[model samples]
Target: MMDIEKLQLHPAYRVVSDDLRQRIVRGEIQPGEPLPTESDLASRFGVHRSTIREGLRQLEQDGLVRRQGKKLLVAVPRNSDLASAAERALRMHQVTFGDVWQVASALEPLCAELAAQRITEAELAALALNIEQTAAHVAHGRSVVASTIEFQSLVAEATRNQALQLARAPVSLLMRAGYAAIAPALPQSGERLLEAHRHVFEALRQHDVEAAVGWTRKHLLDYRRGCEFAGLDLDLPIPLAMPADGPPK
Candidate 1:
């Protein structure tokens, strides 16, 4: 008792890509394994070679397949790659600064807690180097926005949680843009940010889960305060570019 009548057919190239995409996701095909040649794929899919090209192009755009020399290999997408796609989608959907802050406020503290328990010595060392560089940048009155983003990214990476890492990537990228706008106007923000990073870094090194969680939460709250002081409206979308009139405030 289905109400379905006539069904629309998908394009042949789309059909071919969907079939191969399933194999990749299901691990019938694995990362670093070369896909069959276009001729072989065309024969298997019963499509023309040009159709195979079109199908493969979809996978390439999705970051599911990559080319090495002349061969296409199944590939793992980088977090940045995934974030760029997600950021584009979110911006198009008019996701506001408040939306990103809510997600970050939750995810970033969780990341700090996990990192406190699981972070490696090498990661701690990297964070120390980052803090040192960030201090130098702040001292010279250089923009600390990039360093702010990198510090958050390092904390997320140290958690050794792939799912959490992916969840925070877009927010981290978004913060870069938002910080650039506000950091210029708020002089003390950079020093305060460095202090927060150091506190969180120390907590992670000590494996103090409570302290790590507390410091990260405080840091995120400070970011919210900075936004308000800079006159940014949290309800407005982080635009794809500076608005024709001016940035949203």
Candidate 2:
């Protein structure tokens, strides 16, 4: 391996980091797999060990790796992991959850309103598929939370703006995770939840933007109320890292 002094000017660190991240995302480096030793990495990148160390540290902070004694291993991807990174990005740029929620809430009603006017037969079929899956989950004594989120994601997709889709990406991801944690505590379930989506779907089918907007707003507000009723701490500095399933305590 090259000595530390020679490593300072090399551009390989970023190359190696990006490649490793791509591999991780592609599952080439599967979760729980051990990474090559620092010495091995140093040789592969033709850099000093210190550069590898720095790159590894960055990956760890991104929730991509963990050190155990002398070994470094990949970590399982978690929604909270993404949420934590998003939180840091938001704070570093002086963003707040309330600010984001306000914007998200505003955008969503409009998305639903537009979707009401623009939904195609294919989109309606997709919504029906999601609703059927959701009902199946409920019948199986499982939370339909993920299917609910998928339904919203489909609605968002119907909006057809790359900027809106990109902006809503992280919010939808993290919110779904948070919702799964508290879904079991909701006062209504089964027919009630099913009926809610069915009504929204029907409104979209009829191209009723006004009804869509009103009902969409009510749906989101109901979710917030459910979070409160379940005693979830939405204001936590870190996104609430909830278990994959069950009501939060």
Candidate 3:
């Protein structure tokens, strides 16, 4: 016979946190609005103030709540935050380069196509500056992988679509790692990267959607070629370095 009392129960704090999380997710508590006071939450949940604090802490860790002065507010997580979380999940699962490349190839061209239609003058200036810097890096015999990553990021930003920005961020992160791996082995890869970026920038500046998409597709294909030149096994899990404090710029 099984003992009914043998099962362990969840902590009171977790129960409170779960309930509050559901409320926030349901939009009962709107972002940027102050949450109930600790005293009020404790009383409503029939738990101790410490339990309420613990619950709120959990919410904060999950990026659902943030402290403002002495008050706690429901927070909308940023796209960068979501991307970082996705990056961590991918790293933990040992996602392969092929997996990342497939998604990137599909999404990046779309991003370029949309950016050609949506890009503003300010974004075009940024892309021009990025290409100049990338060319300088390449000419100086410096590693242009970081600049290349920024170039791609600028193009994505030019799209002005928050959904596309978030969707492609993890793929971009993985591609940066792939580029870093290949750039050292294939010296001409840097020059090729610069040329591709320049072509993409010109297409966007001219608002030529077909040209933008075509150039971006060619650029992505070059990435695979670079990997092959470097003798990188695409089927192997792509190694993930711990990212810096914020998302790619």
Candidate 4:
């Protein structure tokens, strides 16, 4: 009576994909388990195999499924992988520097506190090496922006909290991008960055939670000052700077 036949319908492939996605999310299909063959899915859903292919493609894009040779499998995506994707989306949405910095200020200190308690010897050694490299880079008057980013990532990894690592990654990326944008004009900021990193590294290595948290908070504050010195406008949306070869890591 309401022109039912005139209503537009969603493609059959999307419907198939949504159904499969729900199954996967509900654990009907476990990670690392092979999906039914496209032919089987086509038969079961009363659709063409091509439609099943299209549906699987959507799941792949969403990081729910992966191909292992000739078979598709339910895949558990890594937190880092998911974070990288989120960072890209944030860039596309024109997230601002202030928006990122506010999140970092809250999460970073907690990450440091946890890392001080949980970091392994290997991670501590890595942090030490990073500090040495950053010192050398600053001494030679080279840009330490990349090293700075890596150092923070190492600290986050040391925390061993998957949720924290994932949540803070985009903020870390934004902080590095902001520094890269302004570091050229603020040469003295390199020394300050190096000092802050060293303090945080020392606290982490010693497993001093209070010191680690305090140093990390201080470092983040210093970053804000550096941005101000460089005259970066926090209110403006952060600029997206993708690598020449591929997407931002």
- Global lDDT of model 3: 0.86
- Deviating ranges (above 4 Å) for candidate 2: 1-12, 15-101, 238-240, 245-249
Evaluated with TM-score, which candidate comes out highest? 1
Better candidate by TM-score, 1 or 4: 1
Writing each residue's lDDT as its tens digit, candidate 3 over 1-249 gives: 865776688999999999999999999999999999999999999999999999999999779999999999999887667787888789779998789999999999999999999999999998888888888888899877677777778889988888999999877877776787777688898888888888899899999999999999999999998877777788877665635321111
Estimate the TM-score for candidate 4.
0.86
After TM-score superposition, the amount by which residue 240's alpha carbon in candidate 2 deviates from its true location, in angstroms, is: 6.5
Ranking by lDDT: 1, 3, 4, 2
Better of 2 and 4 by lDDT: 4
Q: What is the C-alpha lDDT of each candidate?
A: 0.88, 0.73, 0.86, 0.85
Candidate 2 differs from the real structure by a C-alpha RMSD in angstroms, to one decimal, of 9.0
Best by lDDT: 1
RMSD of model 4, in Å?
3.6
For candidate 4, lDDT tens digit of each residue in 202-229?
Answer: 8888999999999989988887777777
lDDT digits (tens) for residues 1-249 of candidate 1? 989879899999999999999999999999999999999999998889999999999999989999999999999987888998988888888888888999999999999999999999999999999999999999999888777888889989998889999988988777765676678668888899999999999899999999999999999998888888888888888887554323354
